[model samples]
Target: MNEFRHVTVLLRETVSALRPRPGGHYLDGTAGGGGHTGLLLEKIQHTGRIEALDRDPDAIAALKKRFAGEPAVTVTQGNFFQAARLFPHPGFHGILLDLGVSSHQLDTPERGFSFHTSAPLDMRMEQDGPTARDLVNTLDEPSLRRILRDYAQEKYAPQIARAMVAQRSAAPIETTTQLADLIAAAVPAAYRREGHPARKTFMALRYACNGELDGLEEALLSLFNLLQPEGRLAVITFNSLEDAAMKRAARQLTAGCTCPPEFPVCVCGKSPRAHSLKPVFPSPEEIERNPRARSAKLRVLERR
Candidate 1:
């Protein structure tokens, strides 16, 4: 746990959105390194409790060790999407969902999340199930292209997919560096110079391998529904795909009057369930301190 160093992103901004109180129960959905969990605990005092939930085994271990013997903190290991089953007694005052990989995961080379290292292509956060290596070595070219295009919006998905299939046919694409270099060479020289061509491809593969975006809306709604009246749900997203999902969930909850304009009168009687707070972004100073925080955005919604 001591080595699990992660610079908490938008720490104050995200937790402050929750507007914690001393006796109100809350949840830290991502709980990586327990950064958000710690801040949430600080503001909440000792009256109520918080559940720190995470999907990664490493994070779960770290969180458990960090908050050991603390009555106010209950560390749980599992995806927050199933939070309903995890915490059956709802009426949560606030809930947070920090979406994306943590710095610890990327910094640890053997985890194979970053292309900077030459480790085996294993991006499984749980350190279980299928890995990036499995997908890259097994999936057909069209499937690979679709993953790249849909997940990361990679413009050169076709070329990259073709290159991966061509390279893997001769030998298994078993390493992060192998895939990264192949992607670098497959794209145009100009695109290569712009940035690492493998960045998007890697992101897409990780997202697919982990099923990150799958059923995201349903999960958000489930968590939101757990909130008590006037309770808030704050979410921090790193990628456009995740941000878009957050936006859709917020809109769906806050939407009202389902009847069409052509009807000229309400019929279905639909009304807003929740309302959003102003979205927050990292400060320039925060971004300079940690470049990864630059892409982070915080959105909060309070139940009606």
Candidate 2:
């Protein structure tokens, strides 16, 4: 395993949104490489406890080793979506969720997250279950097209799906380079000039293989429910799909009433449970240093 050196995006802003206190309990839901966890630990000053969780075994191992003998930190190997079951007794003062693939995952060629390098088509964050190769070879043409279109919003989804199906009939597409070449050939030369033609296709496959968006709503709701009164939840999303979901979740949590306009009496009896804070974006200097931070957006909400 290579050294997990992840550049934490919007570091200062995320911590500020969390509003960590000396005695407050924190949750680093996606503790990739422990960059954010380290900052949280510093703010808490050994007075608070942090429960850091990650689905990747490599990340968990790295975190355990990094924070060894630290009485304030607890590292766990699990998905943040299953956090509700993972931590039954929840009174979290703040929770941080940096959603999407980490820099370490994309840099590792064997992980098959990047098209720049040649490796097996395995994009599982947890390193289990069906891989990208399995999905590329086994899924039917329509299903493949749907994944590309829905998950990645790829415009050439149908063409790419047809090309993949036709090529796999001859031999299994077992590597990242093979799939990249296939996608490049499926799209036009002009289209390829805009960006790596395989980028969207690869993203769709990874999302589908890991079921990334399936339980996102439930997970966000679960985290929100776990917050202590006036506690904050900070989330950093990379793409529009995730941003839209977070916005909707925040709005739903902060919505006040559902009673009819004509009915004067309050029938629903529902009150706003949370409120959204101003969103934060990376500065020009930050994006210049880390291009991956270019698309990052951080949104926060506080329990009422």
**Candidate No. with top TM-score:** 2
Highest-scoring model, lDDT: 2
Reference-based TM-score of each model: 0.97, 0.99
What is the lDDT of every predicted structure here? 0.92, 0.93
| lDDT tens digits by residue: candidate 1, 19-53 | 89999899898999998889889898866989899
Deviation (Å) of 124 in candidate 2: 0.4
Candidate 1 least-lDDT 10 residues: 1-10
lDDT of 2 by residue, 1-304 (tens): 9898799999989987899889889999999899899999999897789999999988998899999999999999999998989999999999999998888999999999989999999999999999999999999999999999999999999999999999999999999999999999999999999999999999999889888887687789889999999999999999998888898899899999899889988889999999999889999999999999999999999999
Let me know the TM-score candidate 2 reaches against the reference structure: 0.99
- Candidate 1 — which pairs collide? none
